[model samples]
Target: RANRDHAAGCVTPVISQNSLISSIAQNVLSINPFQQMINEIIKQKIAPLETRMQQLEEMVQDLQERNDCLNYKTNDLAQYQRRCAFHIYGIAENKEGNKNAIIKYIGKVMGVKVEDSDIYASHRLKQNKQGDDC
Candidate 1:
């Protein structure tokens, strides 16, 4: 048949099943080590990077919580400071308004007999949010 085809100038394509199977097997065998090497690289380098990123995220969260606590403490300290301070309304703004004299006057009016040493500090208030001129 091959001779007849050659004599008739007809080309016959040849395909070997064994050759195709061997080529596929060789490709499959070659890919295994490369895939294993890629897996090892991910485990060695990328895995540690992922762990470090998680640790950094945890540290940032801890710092944020610490900052919130500090802010709360600062607010508490401000409130405590204001606790020692007193505000007296309806006191007009005068250039010669002495704080000590005003304290004494208030003490006498309330019959408390407050002395200069007993008082810490005093100041006239401005117009309040309710439009009360103090």
Candidate 2:
């Protein structure tokens, strides 16, 4: 049997060009335009986004607080629909129209109270029994 050799005098080449082509076909192109995109984005867009996000978070917190207050008032109103109490005397606010709002808001919830009468309505909660441990 005669062994045919190339001009370079190479031995039997088991791995040919087809195997290299197959390997290249299996891989995908990973194109990265910038080496420091994340840093640049943080410097450019992220600061504003973080500031706005902080503002949004603060607004959400304010809304939640106002919502809790409104919920409490709404529940109290639902409990007593027929009559309402207006507590006007205690710590009268210096603001002109704020007093009216407070009076009206309170009146819609409870029965009704005058602007000057000192009527005490205390809420006694059920105390939890102390355990023997402490």
Candidate 1 residues 64-134, lDDT tens each? 99999999999999998888677776677788778888888988999989888887777665676889654
Error of 1 at 54 (Å): 2.1
lDDT of 2 by residue, 1-134 (tens): 13454623453243555676666765522224353666687689878988999999999999999999999999988777525433233343353445445554676678766352332232222333662322
Identify the runs in model 1 with alpha carbons over 4 angstroms from their true place. 1-15, 92-94, 111-120, 128-134
- Lowest-lDDT window of 10 residues in candidate 1? 7-16
Off by over 4 Å in 2: 1-38, 82-134
lDDT at 50, model 2? 86
Local distance difference test, per candidate?
0.83, 0.58
Clashes of each: 0, 8
Residue 6 miss distance in model 2 (angstroms): 26
Against the true structure, what is each candidate's TM-score?
0.69, 0.33
